[model samples]
Target: MGNIDKRNRLDEAPFRYAVTKTNTVFIDYEGKQIKVLKGKEAEKFLKRVNAADSEKELQLIMAKITGNFKRGNER
Candidate 1:
Protein backbone atom coordinates (compact mmCIF):
# COMPACT_ATOMS: atom_id res chain seq x y z
CA MET A 1 0.00 0.00 0.00
CA GLY A 2 1.03 3.61 -0.58
CA ASN A 3 1.76 6.22 2.10
CA ILE A 4 -1.83 7.47 2.31
CA ASP A 5 -3.25 3.94 2.58
CA LYS A 6 -0.74 3.03 5.27
CA ARG A 7 -1.27 6.29 7.13
CA ASN A 8 -5.04 5.84 7.12
CA ARG A 9 -4.71 2.67 9.16
CA LEU A 10 -2.06 3.98 11.55
CA ASP A 11 -2.31 3.77 15.34
CA GLU A 12 -3.32 7.39 15.57
CA ALA A 13 -6.26 7.86 13.20
CA PRO A 14 -6.45 11.62 12.93
CA PHE A 15 -9.92 12.33 11.69
CA ARG A 16 -13.28 13.73 12.66
CA TYR A 17 -16.82 13.49 11.19
CA ALA A 18 -18.45 16.87 10.72
CA VAL A 19 -21.64 16.33 8.72
CA THR A 20 -23.13 13.76 6.35
CA LYS A 21 -23.71 13.64 2.59
CA THR A 22 -24.47 17.08 1.07
CA ASN A 23 -23.84 18.96 4.30
CA THR A 24 -20.54 17.25 5.05
CA VAL A 25 -17.59 19.34 6.27
CA PHE A 26 -14.02 18.83 7.54
CA ILE A 27 -11.25 21.18 8.58
CA ASP A 28 -7.59 20.52 9.38
CA TYR A 29 -5.88 23.74 10.35
CA GLU A 30 -2.16 23.83 11.24
CA GLY A 31 -2.32 20.14 12.28
CA LYS A 32 -5.43 20.59 14.39
CA GLN A 33 -8.87 19.32 13.41
CA ILE A 34 -12.11 21.26 13.58
CA LYS A 35 -15.70 20.62 12.58
CA VAL A 36 -18.25 23.32 11.87
CA LEU A 37 -21.65 23.53 10.20
CA LYS A 38 -22.00 24.15 6.46
CA GLY A 39 -23.16 27.07 4.29
CA LYS A 40 -22.96 30.49 5.98
CA GLU A 41 -21.64 29.05 9.20
CA ALA A 42 -18.73 27.46 7.39
CA GLU A 43 -18.00 30.73 5.60
CA LYS A 44 -17.87 32.67 8.83
CA PHE A 45 -15.66 30.06 10.45
CA LEU A 46 -13.23 30.14 7.54
CA LYS A 47 -12.93 33.89 7.89
CA ARG A 48 -12.07 33.49 11.55
CA VAL A 49 -9.45 30.85 10.78
CA ASN A 50 -7.87 33.11 8.20
CA ALA A 51 -7.68 35.87 10.80
CA ALA A 52 -6.21 33.80 13.62
CA ASP A 53 -2.85 34.99 15.01
CA SER A 54 -2.21 32.32 17.62
CA GLU A 55 -3.54 29.02 18.96
CA LYS A 56 -5.65 30.95 21.46
CA GLU A 57 -7.01 32.98 18.59
CA LEU A 58 -7.96 29.77 16.79
CA GLN A 59 -9.73 28.35 19.85
CA LEU A 60 -11.65 31.57 20.37
CA ILE A 61 -12.50 31.54 16.71
CA MET A 62 -13.84 28.00 17.04
CA ALA A 63 -15.88 28.95 20.10
CA LYS A 64 -17.49 31.72 18.10
CA ILE A 65 -18.04 29.42 15.14
CA THR A 66 -19.86 26.90 17.37
CA GLY A 67 -21.89 29.54 19.22
CA ASN A 68 -20.50 28.27 22.51
CA PHE A 69 -19.88 31.70 24.00
CA LYS A 70 -22.25 33.97 25.82
CA ARG A 71 -22.60 37.59 24.64
CA GLY A 72 -20.26 38.68 27.44
CA ASN A 73 -17.53 36.27 26.31
CA GLU A 74 -17.63 37.08 22.61
CA ARG A 75 -15.61 39.78 21.00
Candidate 2:
Protein backbone atom coordinates (compact mmCIF):
# COMPACT_ATOMS: atom_id res chain seq x y z
CA MET A 1 0.00 0.00 0.00
CA GLY A 2 1.09 3.57 -0.60
CA ASN A 3 -0.01 6.90 0.83
CA ILE A 4 -0.55 9.11 -2.17
CA ASP A 5 -2.02 12.56 -1.73
CA LYS A 6 -3.46 14.71 -4.51
CA ARG A 7 -3.56 18.43 -4.09
CA ASN A 8 -3.82 21.50 -6.32
CA ARG A 9 -0.40 23.11 -5.95
CA LEU A 10 -1.48 26.25 -7.81
CA ASP A 11 -3.48 27.11 -4.73
CA GLU A 12 -0.18 27.17 -2.86
CA ALA A 13 1.53 29.37 -5.40
CA PRO A 14 2.90 32.67 -4.14
CA PHE A 15 2.65 34.65 -7.36
CA ARG A 16 -0.34 35.77 -9.39
CA TYR A 17 -0.99 34.55 -12.96
CA ALA A 18 -0.43 37.45 -15.33
CA VAL A 19 -0.44 35.76 -18.70
CA THR A 20 -2.57 32.86 -19.77
CA LYS A 21 -2.45 31.02 -23.11
CA THR A 22 -3.25 34.25 -24.93
CA ASN A 23 -4.24 37.34 -23.01
CA THR A 24 -2.23 39.06 -20.29
CA VAL A 25 -4.25 40.31 -17.37
CA PHE A 26 -3.88 41.02 -13.66
CA ILE A 27 -6.06 42.06 -10.78
CA ASP A 28 -5.59 45.35 -9.02
CA TYR A 29 -5.87 46.00 -5.29
CA GLU A 30 -9.45 47.09 -5.89
CA GLY A 31 -10.15 43.66 -7.37
CA LYS A 32 -10.58 45.10 -10.83
CA GLN A 33 -9.21 43.09 -13.76
CA ILE A 34 -6.46 45.07 -15.45
CA LYS A 35 -5.25 44.13 -18.90
CA VAL A 36 -2.15 46.24 -19.29
CA LEU A 37 0.07 43.90 -21.22
CA LYS A 38 0.02 42.35 -24.68
CA GLY A 39 -0.08 44.22 -27.97
CA LYS A 40 1.00 47.85 -27.50
CA GLU A 41 0.85 47.63 -23.73
CA ALA A 42 3.64 45.07 -23.69
CA GLU A 43 6.06 47.75 -24.82
CA LYS A 44 5.46 49.70 -21.64
CA PHE A 45 6.05 46.74 -19.36
CA LEU A 46 9.11 45.44 -21.22
CA LYS A 47 11.43 48.03 -19.69
CA ARG A 48 10.37 47.16 -16.16
CA VAL A 49 10.93 43.45 -16.66
CA ASN A 50 14.37 44.16 -18.13
CA ALA A 51 15.43 46.71 -15.52
CA ALA A 52 18.19 45.86 -13.02
CA ASP A 53 15.97 46.30 -10.00
CA SER A 54 13.22 44.19 -11.53
CA GLU A 55 15.65 41.42 -12.48
CA LYS A 56 17.09 41.35 -8.98
CA GLU A 57 13.66 41.26 -7.42
CA LEU A 58 12.55 38.46 -9.75
CA GLN A 59 15.63 36.39 -8.89
CA LEU A 60 15.14 36.87 -5.18
CA ILE A 61 11.43 36.08 -5.17
CA MET A 62 11.62 33.10 -7.52
CA ALA A 63 14.56 31.65 -5.58
CA LYS A 64 12.53 31.71 -2.39
CA ILE A 65 9.49 30.14 -4.06
CA THR A 66 11.37 27.43 -6.02
CA GLY A 67 13.27 26.53 -2.85
CA ASN A 68 10.05 26.13 -0.86
CA PHE A 69 8.64 23.15 -2.79
CA LYS A 70 7.62 20.12 -0.72
CA ARG A 71 6.99 16.52 -1.76
CA GLY A 72 3.56 14.95 -1.37
CA ASN A 73 4.84 12.68 1.39
CA GLU A 74 6.18 15.67 3.27
CA ARG A 75 2.90 17.55 3.03
Candidate 3:
Protein backbone atom coordinates (compact mmCIF):
# COMPACT_ATOMS: atom_id res chain seq x y z
CA MET A 1 0.00 0.00 0.00
CA GLY A 2 2.81 2.38 0.78
CA ASN A 3 4.49 1.84 -2.61
CA ILE A 4 1.19 2.31 -4.43
CA ASP A 5 0.49 5.53 -2.54
CA LYS A 6 3.69 7.15 -3.82
CA ARG A 7 2.12 9.91 -5.93
CA ASN A 8 5.43 11.26 -7.15
CA ARG A 9 6.44 7.91 -8.61
CA LEU A 10 6.37 7.33 -12.34
CA ASP A 11 5.73 3.94 -13.91
CA GLU A 12 6.35 2.75 -17.46
CA ALA A 13 3.31 1.27 -19.13
CA PRO A 14 3.46 -0.73 -22.34
CA PHE A 15 5.18 1.36 -25.07
CA ARG A 16 6.03 4.05 -22.54
CA TYR A 17 9.26 5.99 -22.99
CA ALA A 18 12.02 5.52 -20.45
CA VAL A 19 14.87 8.02 -20.42
CA THR A 20 18.10 6.76 -18.94
CA LYS A 21 21.06 8.77 -17.70
CA THR A 22 24.68 8.15 -18.55
CA ASN A 23 27.70 10.01 -19.85
CA THR A 24 27.58 8.02 -23.10
CA VAL A 25 25.15 6.18 -25.36
CA PHE A 26 23.40 2.81 -25.14
CA ILE A 27 21.50 0.18 -27.07
CA ASP A 28 18.73 -1.46 -25.06
CA TYR A 29 16.64 -4.45 -26.04
CA GLU A 30 14.69 -7.09 -24.25
CA GLY A 31 17.16 -8.73 -21.80
CA LYS A 32 19.92 -6.50 -23.13
CA GLN A 33 21.34 -3.03 -22.55
CA ILE A 34 24.61 -2.24 -24.25
CA LYS A 35 26.57 1.02 -24.44
CA VAL A 36 27.27 1.07 -28.15
CA LEU A 37 24.59 3.39 -29.50
CA LYS A 38 25.38 7.03 -30.21
CA GLY A 39 23.19 10.12 -29.69
CA LYS A 40 19.51 9.14 -29.22
CA GLU A 41 19.93 5.77 -30.92
CA ALA A 42 18.84 3.86 -27.86
CA GLU A 43 15.59 5.77 -27.58
CA LYS A 44 14.82 5.33 -31.27
CA PHE A 45 15.59 1.64 -31.04
CA LEU A 46 13.27 1.19 -28.07
CA LYS A 47 10.47 3.11 -29.80
CA ARG A 48 10.83 0.98 -32.90
CA VAL A 49 10.78 -2.21 -30.87
CA ASN A 50 7.71 -1.11 -28.93
CA ALA A 51 5.89 -0.12 -32.09
CA ALA A 52 6.70 -3.43 -33.70
CA ASP A 53 5.42 -5.30 -30.68
CA SER A 54 2.22 -3.26 -30.65
CA GLU A 55 1.74 -3.82 -34.36
CA LYS A 56 2.18 -7.57 -33.92
CA GLU A 57 -0.31 -7.63 -31.06
CA LEU A 58 -2.82 -5.63 -33.08
CA GLN A 59 -2.41 -7.97 -36.03
CA LEU A 60 -3.02 -11.01 -33.84
CA ILE A 61 -6.08 -9.45 -32.28
CA MET A 62 -7.44 -8.34 -35.62
CA ALA A 63 -6.96 -11.80 -37.07
CA LYS A 64 -8.76 -13.39 -34.15
CA ILE A 65 -11.68 -10.99 -34.34
CA THR A 66 -11.92 -11.29 -38.11
CA GLY A 67 -11.85 -15.09 -37.91
CA ASN A 68 -8.42 -16.58 -38.42
CA PHE A 69 -9.12 -19.23 -40.99
CA LYS A 70 -7.07 -20.62 -43.83
CA ARG A 71 -8.33 -21.28 -47.31
CA GLY A 72 -7.40 -20.81 -50.93
CA ASN A 73 -6.23 -17.27 -51.64
CA GLU A 74 -8.95 -16.65 -54.22
CA ARG A 75 -9.29 -12.96 -54.87
Global lDDT of each candidate = 0.48, 0.38, 0.35
Sliding window of 10 residues with minimal summed lDDT for model 3: 8-17
The candidates, ranked best first by TM-score, are 1, 2, 3
lDDT sort, best first: 1, 2, 3
Estimated TM-score for each candidate:
0.42, 0.29, 0.24
Q: What would the per-residue lDDT of candidate 3 be over residues 1-75, giving only the tens digit for each residue?
A: 233314312122211223457523333323244235435765555445556544444333222222311232311
Clashes (backbone N, CA, C under 3 Å), per candidate, total 0, 0, 0
- Name the best candidate (by lDDT): 1
Per-residue lDDT tens digits of candidate 1, residues 1-75?
233233232223223234457654565333555554688766665676678675545554554454433344322
Question: What is residue 58's positional error in candidate 3, in angstroms?
Answer: 15
TM-score of candidate 1 versus the correct structure, residues matched by position: 0.42
Q: Please write out the lDDT profile of model 2 over residues 1-75, one tens digit for every residue.
A: 012113543334333325555545342212334334565555444444456264335433332333433454423
Model 2, runs deviating above 4 Å = 1-17, 52-75
Residue 19 error for model 2, in Å?
A: 1.9
lDDT of prediction 2:
0.38
